[model samples]
Target: MNATVVYELAGSYFGGTSSRPVPAKLVVADDRLRVIAGDDLLAGPLPLAEIVVSSRLGNTPRMLRFADGASFETAGNATVDRLLAGQGRRHGLVHRLESSLRYVLVGLLVTIAFVWGGVRYGIPALAEATAFALPEAASRQIGEGVLELLDDDLLFPSELTAEEQARLRQRFVPMIAASGLPIRLEFRKAARELGANAFALPSGTVVFTDQLVKLAEHDEELLGVLAHEIGHIDRRHGLRQVLQSSALGLLTMTVTGDVSSVSSLIAAIPAILTQLGYSRDFEYEADDFAAELMANHRIDAAQLGTMLMRLEDALRKCPEVERCADPERGWTTYLSTHPPTTERLQRLTKR
Candidate 1:
């Protein structure tokens, strides 16, 4: 056998392992490997059946291990290249990916594009479909968890009278009944924080903050807000948001074959509630929903536009530093990606 590659060889000794590298020569021929040092034989004239190779991923030095616990580590340019050409091991996906500079560049671009598509379109689409497909029991559990978190961190006791609550909920009775889903309504005081806002829970619960109710100049405006929130519930935006937020973690788990990572995402549902940051398109969809619903009910859709404009003004009045009080940390506030209020108003004008 011709001399192959030199490696710094070290292995476990007694209670601890040596960190030193000894110069040696390795050769492979006739389906056998041999190692030689100055005046000694180390590992070889052994059949290839005893050798175990390491993956070529990352920058870690490639290692060749023998059944007898003998091993060699090298930068792997010579040995791996030679062994790969010899055809003992199959080329791995990662190896193929690392085969050339062009592959690396092209793979990187494709990877970026793939991940961006997943995050931007694929994850959300899957979540949207899955949200509606999910059993009612799951959404109920998720909604309960979210409400508990809000109670602990953001919501205060409602100050509105029972009559006001009942009256406000009355308007949505037909819509809720038509949807055939168990939609519940709740109210809470905003505690001079979070200002005026309404959001939908995964279980078809629509919550109205006291400030939000007070902010409305008329029943029509409140109806507009309710319609908007119902739009979110109808689209399962809360659940979709949760799924989207956990997409990367889920992908990592899938790639690494770690199935348990899903448990963390499930357990973190409440945490995701405060992060229900809808995309701009989601906001537009919700706005369109509110408009169409209003128009179908013979109610002026412009009231929603007016209401959004008023809410925008109110949100702008609230100082930036003060927005930290919301459990969502003003995520649904001005910091949100909801389409500009002007856009909604423009659409209403066209209507």
Candidate 2:
């Protein structure tokens, strides 16, 4: 009779049943062992002291013949002597087995949590990598389409002329190329009402609102912003974000495939676009890239720094003008995705 006794575990045999190989940590608990096995308790705390030499099952079943010639099958779940062999509470079957099992389960849960978090942040990176591999022409087309989609009449002026567009391209294209991004530049004829914004699309296109163009005192200031956006492009940050959003859309559409799903995805477009900010590392890389471009072109890195300060100041005074300005906030999901302005300025100054 095998029973798990909570008190003193002395001389008992305890072990689990195995089809092929026997388990190592098998032992018993207490003098008169009371075990809980499955739903039903087993054969006895009966005075089994006469039971001499209890043996556990191995691959081969051997009936032990005692000094008295009495033999019993070791083929059962656990022998009583084995269960009783456990010495103390810490070493007992319940303590050893249950505690080890609990720890194993906990370890599994922690691993799962780590994996989930990595996937959540990693999907965008995966998407970006894929986007970077795309041809420059395809990327530009995507940027153009996004600009058309986002720039409402209130945000973008009516139209830009071919000559003006060429001028903007001339200013931006070489810089983008030098930054190792296969990106094309598109300019809005009239400044966007949205004030001083430039962004990239999945297809290798970057757009600067006319207002953004007018706001820059020097080409380097524009390059600073453009470089940041290019950083987003080179790292495939924007493409990854767009892909992640689209993947979410696909999941929603799979679940509900209705007009509501379409509307929901459309409604989420702004958040999706705005949410695709670069990480601190990416931001720094872009800043350095811009700085190098400026240095090579003999442009002042401090001017880029100045532009940032100006943008920061503008956001503070005209908070209502910018939708995504979190004044003096720290460690935001958004901010975490972007490099800090202070570091960029410091690095530039040091250079």
Return the top candidate by TM-score.
1
- Candidate 1 lDDT over 36-61, as tens digits, reads 67667766787765677776776656
**CA lDDT for candidate 1:** 0.71
- Where model 1 places Cα greater than 4 Å from the true spot, the runs are 1-32, 35-60, 63-76, 79-99, 250-278, 319-335, 348-351
- RMSD of every candidate to native, in Å, equals 7.5, 12.1
As a whole number from 0 to 100, the lDDT of residue 33 in candidate 1 is 74
User: All models: lDDT?
Assistant: 0.71, 0.56
Off by over 4 Å in 2: 1-105, 120-144, 158-169, 173-182, 189-193, 243-281, 319-326, 330-337
